[model samples]
Target: MTEQVSAASNAAVDTISRAGWGAELRATFALAWPLVIAQLAQNALHTTDVIMLGRLGPAYLAAGTLATTFLNAFLLGSIGVVGAVAPLVAQARGARDIKAVRRVVRQGCWAAIIISVVMIPLLLQIKPIYLALGQDPLATDMAEQFIQIAAWSMFPALGIIAFRSFLSAYDATRAILVITVLGVLINALIAYTLIFGHFGFPRLELRGAAIATLTTNFIMLGMMVAYVLRHRRLKRFNVLVRFWKPDWPRLREIFRIGLPIGLTVLAEVGLFTAAALLMGRLGTDEVAAHAVALQLASMAFMVPLGLGVAATVRVGIAFGRGDIDGVGNAGWTAFVLGLGFMAVSCTLFLTAGTFLVSLFLDMNEPTNANAIGLAITFLMVAGIFQLVDGAQVVAAHSLRGLSDTKVPMLVAIVGYWAVGLPISYVLGFVFNWRGVGIWLGLAAGLAAVAVVLVARFAMRERLGLMRSRA
Candidate 1:
């Protein structure tokens, strides 16, 4: 009888383990594929702009690239704060609490607006700082003009993100994919027309790219808001009912969770932006090469990024449902998927890097050969870090699902700013290793962060399971 009981227990444990991993893999990729598509579409806007401007020459490419570096640092980081709502919404869904979910959404909108306002002065100040940092005056001037047009779109952009988080939590992933495809296609056509002065539009060049991007932001915002306002299913959430009412406590809670997230994002972005700035000190050719490599890397990065976000939703829901094992399962599953995908990216970057670099520049142009050659080298460096970068981002998002924000924020500071930046400066300038050294430092920083954050989530998962059992 004892032998039979032991055999039964072993079988049960095996079944549960299979079930956990199976659910996590299916659930995670189900949501992640659509998210990856949406992210790719959104990033393609920048890619399209860069490709179009590349036709004008390396100088034009540098202008758009330089402007986007600061824009990504400040603007994209602020949007990351808005994403804090995803976990909150997912938790609410798991608990079957509609009112709590709606409350978070409305509060998030207000936070987005407030944050957008704070960003204006910062965006306006980019040009002066770029000049002081000794960037090419012509490229800096072009970057300034792009910011002038692009800055105003921050409000709607953040607003779109708020709704996006809400929708993702409820598994409304298809909505974003549809809207994102439309936005990117429209932006590309409009950008081509405006940049080339076709269809009666004046040739606006780099500024036209800015305008095209801004137009898409507004379109996305309007579509998302309209869906929220009119959808019969979503109406019960009452997202618009207290549209103007302020909930200070709720707002404070979001900021408490979100500011850390924003700062974490800011630190990582700042590291790369700083590197871009340092490259600027080298020359326009180096900056242009860095730009192409970074853009390509960012494009491939969206896949792991989307998977990481899907993990946040999965883990948060599992947490709310009081399934601690499920949280670990979801987190680990996503991490595996993310790292796997990036490894494939690594192989591509290693094998066909020159061919990939050729897509962004005119190979026949003798002037661009230097920049293209430099980009291929940086692409190889980028390939080396893809696995670690994927793992770190996935781990960070998993932690976010557990309302564990502060530690990861601190880790980002230590990893990126302290460990990464100083090494970059020492190797690139002091040791005269140049651009390659800066990218090496970046790889070291990502590896450190991956180790730290993955360890944090592992510890947290055990603690959460212990508490649940208690």
Candidate 2:
């Protein structure tokens, strides 16, 4: 482990020398840690849902997992639209263009609201789709109910993301962090009380979890809206200034950049969601295992995701400032941090995967043993792709900062769907590798994406396109 750390440190030092030291690590970390904590808190909130559902037995876990998987495939994919806020606002902030920042945030929020409205109907239809796909009728029915209740949360969730992106771009991450902590606490308490019928609440099971999540979404959005409206500096952006103004050109620009990001996110998330659905076809136990392993992977992924957020800001700012060296430094530094962090995660997954997966299952429940067993297998394959997953995500976000979305989107389509999905289907079904094969396919896809994405960013730098265009 020490030697691994030494090698990772040496690699970072080497990257710093080549990339130059203009993008400050200290500044980046300062901006990044709070964001990381907030992301962990959010994932922890979601994992809490998994843990709570898991305790109810594999049926409950499988049902909730399947439903959320479907909803997230759409919800997160659309969120790619709100993601435009960070880079758009950061670049505007870099140029100290107050009007541009305000316009972007307000317009971005409008975009989120519009996207949320469209997502609701899609979520409402999850059950029929599940049935059409031949999922267990009982599980499909329960999942459908869950999505119906959960669908309402998307409106506020989208709003929160938009505002959160705006705040993150400005380095005002702490307020968002505090609210997220409160949200997790709220979600945990509400989920527990309602799930177990504690504190005189109804034991609505899956419905209770959705209600808790939805309730948190509303409150979090309220807090975000309030914060933006009241915070001295944030208020200066006038995010809430005019609710009905039309900025046709700016909205078009945002959609132009954001649509590809949305598709890219959709493509990647669609792969995993497809994997989850495929696991369901195998059995409840398979789905349960896949859910557990994916949740852990997601938790670990927050580090890179947060770094990616920071990279978007730092690199976007550098781009706006016309700092060629800073763009290289920011992007490379984030890649180093993200990959190095995931290296530690890979070690943990490799060394203690059984124990980690065990936390999501009840060892005493004999029925859950299957899930635990399958999850252990998946974690090993998950560990294999940790570095590459980090590589792709970090590099992708850096490109996003360059406002380079379309090509990256194309790269993702080819990498995840073209390469990853086909391979997963072949290995899992064709070769009969089953659970393990599905994960291997994911690893392969991510590895391909990592190679191509990093190379793409490198080429952009070499050609001076990122700097010259900015």
Candidate 3:
């Protein structure tokens, strides 16, 4: 069965390699739309939490935002590490090495467990970290309460990422979409019931929200695991059988490729986390407003992120087959698509920023006017950087498909930490621009990274990025 699937995948790659731009565009879109929708649905879970917490008042929203920002930095970084499974699996399938695919998938699950063990303890220490950063004491306490439970979700959440990556490499993404959408609905319901004490539930507030997130993660992980076990094509791999067994070299390979990717993600997410901390120092309202604006930008980012993942699978397959032109076609097509969508979103942010930010707050509340106004201002800055944000992510993922990660990781660190973070600090503090200045710094950092990553992709051959792959 594995052999048959490999033959079919290899033949499909041959067809795609020979196809024209139009076909490539269609193929990429077909692979991308479900992923895009899944990403949106996944984000909606957090959006729902923010929206509800906002109703509890600005203080609650600010606290929740701080906690989630901290959690997501670690979450996304861990996911980036486990996500190496996608390209590894894609390359294996392209070369029709079914056994290798199984090994990668198995090791990906192992990687998830290892990351959870290391990260969960670190996440539990949010209070100390927040205090050291000089966050508001009350807000820090609230945030710690939220993270205590939410931290446990890291286990199932990382597991879900591993399985999702495996499914994506196979282009079996609709299941991911279905599972995530359902998770969003479930999370919303559970959060509402627990937060507000509806339906005889205790009003747990932030803790309730944390419980909802943890429960949802476990459910999503279970669904993904069951699907892999039952699906005709995936079941043959037995990804979970003898889960405790170790494949030392394969495990090392995942860490080797995944660690840099993880750091790259941390560099970018850490920039946002630092911005949140900056906002926390300025005031609760600034933190709340920043959260709203950032949420909107993150939601819009789902499109490019999905396209980036698609590009990884497509380019990985091409690289594995040694089809040089196919790699170029896959990367560029996704790049163009990402840029075009971001242009539209940029326009939306510029034209309707007020309306978008309003959706998260109560329009009737006079107290919300200040936070809403600040959020609109941040949204405008977010709009300005949309294109570059889209470009950097897509280009970086395309490089990952060719198993080129270390350079991009360095690019991210220099771009986000060295360039972006300093600009944010200078403009926001030294220049006294406040929230707007801080946002501009973010824009500057994204632009710098985007230009570098795009140029690197353009010069892939000249840079010898593909030399070792074949």
Model 3 per-residue lDDT tens digits across residues 1-470 = 34433543353354345657677798899999999999999999999999999999999999999899999999999999998998899899889898888888899888999999999999999999989999999999999999999999988998898899889989899999999999999999999999999999899999999999999999999999999999998999988778888899999989999999999999999999999999888998899899999999999999999999999999999898888888888988898899999999999999999889888988789998888899999999999999999999999999999999999999999999999999999999999999999999999999888878877777687789888665
Model 2 clash count equals 0
Task: Select the stronger candidate by lDDT from 2 and 3.
Answer: 3
Pairs of colliding residues, candidate 2: none
Per-residue error for 111 in candidate 3, Å, reads 0.8
What C-alpha lDDT do the candidate models reach, one value each?
0.87, 0.87, 0.91
Order the numbered candidates by lDDT, best leading. 3, 2, 1
Candidate 1: lDDT over CA atoms?
Answer: 0.87
Give a tens-digit lDDT track for model 1, residues 1-470: 34433543353244336657886788888898999899899899889999999998988899998998878888878987888899888888888888889889999999999999999888988778998888888999989988888888899899998999998998888888998899889899989998888999899998899999899899988998888777788867889786899988878888888999999999999999999999999998899999989988999899989988898999889888887678778887888889889999999999999899999998999999889899999999999999999989998998888878898999999999889999989999999999999999999888888877877676673445326422
- Candidate 3 overall Cα lDDT vs. reference? 0.91
RMSD of each: 5.2, 3.5, 6.2
- Give per-residue lDDT, candidate 1, residue 16: 34
Model 2, 1-470: lDDT tens digits are 34434543454465578635643787788899999999999898789999999999988999999889988898898888888888998888778789998888888878988898888887898877888988899999988878889988888888888899899998999998999999999999999998889988779999999999999999998998899889898887777787689788888888999999999999999999889878877888899999999999999999999999999999899888887767778888888889899999999999999789878998778878778999988998888899999989999999999999998899999999999999999999999999898999999889888777777776675545575545
Superposed Cα deviation of residue 284, candidate 2 (Å): 0.9
